[model samples]
Target: MKKVLIVGAHGATAQIVTARLLAETDDQLVLYLRQSRRLAQYADNARVTLVDGDVSDIEKLTAAMAGVDVVYSNIGGVDLGTQTKHLLTAMQQAHQTRLIFMSALGAHHEVPGKFGDWNEQAIHDFLPGFREAAQLLATSKLDYTEVRPAWLTNTDEIDYETTTLADGFKGTEVSRASVADFMIKVIADPSLYRRESIGLDKPGTDGDQPSWL
Candidate 1:
């Protein structure tokens, strides 16, 4: 079974990813989060190994990466750029390369039209760090796929399409299941979106803004 390291394992999307991994594959999981107690439900799960540490704690992070086949990093916040660098350092020390990073849709100013304007205005503060994290992965030697999901939703459906770094992002929102599905697919086949910044969105959902608003 493959050993998977999931940073920010307590996130909503990461929760879905981990659940699927547990039920769908025989993979072993190293759940790394700032607060380990958050995943107390998985304490009895033989396949799950929870570790408490920040990404900036390179020593702990590096140790957690031992024998991991792939890393799924679902983290954010103002200091995300710095966190990404720390993760890279730890991964390097562990001699692992494959990474599937969770990013936001407007990360590279890649969204278009009114929806783009809305998205930009909504999260302008976090864009710089997201852009920086994306750029860091783009230039790094690691085999990475920066997952930029178009506004997220708790919808149970797993329906979505993708756009590359060269293409403009589409749709207003995509379900967390859809984003997690894509990540699981990548885990099953690392060569799928090699070294790409992919935008995930539900087809035909494009609009000036998410329907909820």
Candidate 2:
């Protein structure tokens, strides 16, 4: 069984993935997040280990990387670039190479038409760090899959479409559950989508912007 390290395990999507892993696989989990107590329900679970720390803490991150086979990052913020850098450093030092990261759809400006323009104007502030993180991963030697999810929704269903970096992104919104499902797939099968970027969106939900807006 793969020992998976889920950074930012406190987040919504991460939590979904964590539950799915426990119910579906025999994998061991190391759930790392700042407020570890928030996920106290899993504290007694034999398959789960809670780690209270930030990804920026290289020392703790590297220490937690012990015996980890795959690292799935579900955190994003203004300091994403710095966090990504630290994660890469820790992984390298620990001799870990596989990573599954959640990036933005516009990180590479791969979205098309007016929707793309609207997206750029909407979340412009968050793009730089995501873009920078993407570039850093592109240059790194690790086997990483950058998931660029479209506008997010709280929907419980897992319905989505995917596009590559070379193709234009599709749809306007994708459920967090969908993204979580895809990440679980990668964690279960590391060879799937190795060293590529994937754009995730709900099929037929295309528009000038997300439906919620």
Candidate 3:
């Protein structure tokens, strides 16, 4: 069975992805989180091996990468660039490939659609890190797929679409559940592997900006 390590596995999206993997696949899952208490709710999931550690710590991250077939990173922050750098270094040291990174929609340039201003600001502020992370992933021999979602909602729906960077989708938002589903789908099908990044959004949704944006 494939061994998958999910960073930020305590987050909402990670939790859903964990559940789906446990139910649908025979793969082993290693849930990596900074705080062990965050996984209390899932204490009974025998298929899950919880590791309390920080993604930015190379030693800890490398330990978590042992025998991992797929690494799904959903960790984000203002200092995400630093985090990604460490992650890349650890993965490289471990000689592990197959990565799925969850990044924001406006990671490259500013789009004038929904959440444009805030997203632009965020990208501008964090672009250096995001770009660096993308560069490391793109240059690596690893099979990587960067999934960028517009606004994230907590709705319990699985309706969404994947679009290229030039799709010019305006004000599109997707549920966290859908994002998790998309991650699982891509992981299950190696053919879906795309080195390029893609945008995700809910169908028929307007106002693409997230409240926090």
TM-score between model 3 and native: 0.88
RMSD of each: 0.8, 0.8, 2.5
Per-residue error for 155 in candidate 1, Å, reads 0.6
Per residue, candidate 2 scores C-alpha lDDT tens digits across 100-166 of 9989889998999999999988888999999999999999999999999999999989999889988
Report the alpha-carbon TM-score of model 1 versus the true structure.
0.98
Candidate models: Cα lDDT each: 0.94, 0.93, 0.80
Model 2, position 68: C-alpha lDDT score: 94
Off by over 4 Å in 1: none
- Candidate 1's displacement at residue 154, Å, is 0.4
lDDT of 1 by residue, 68-170 (tens): 9999999999889999999999989999999999999888998999999998999989999999998899889999999999989999999999999787888
**Is 1 or 3 the stronger prediction by lDDT?**
1
Count of residue pairs whose backbone atoms collide, per candidate: 0, 0, 1
Check candidate 2 and list the clashing pairs.
none
* Residues forming the 10-long window of minimal summed lDDT in candidate 3: 204-213
lDDT tens string, model 3, 161-190? Answer: 877766654555789998998899887875
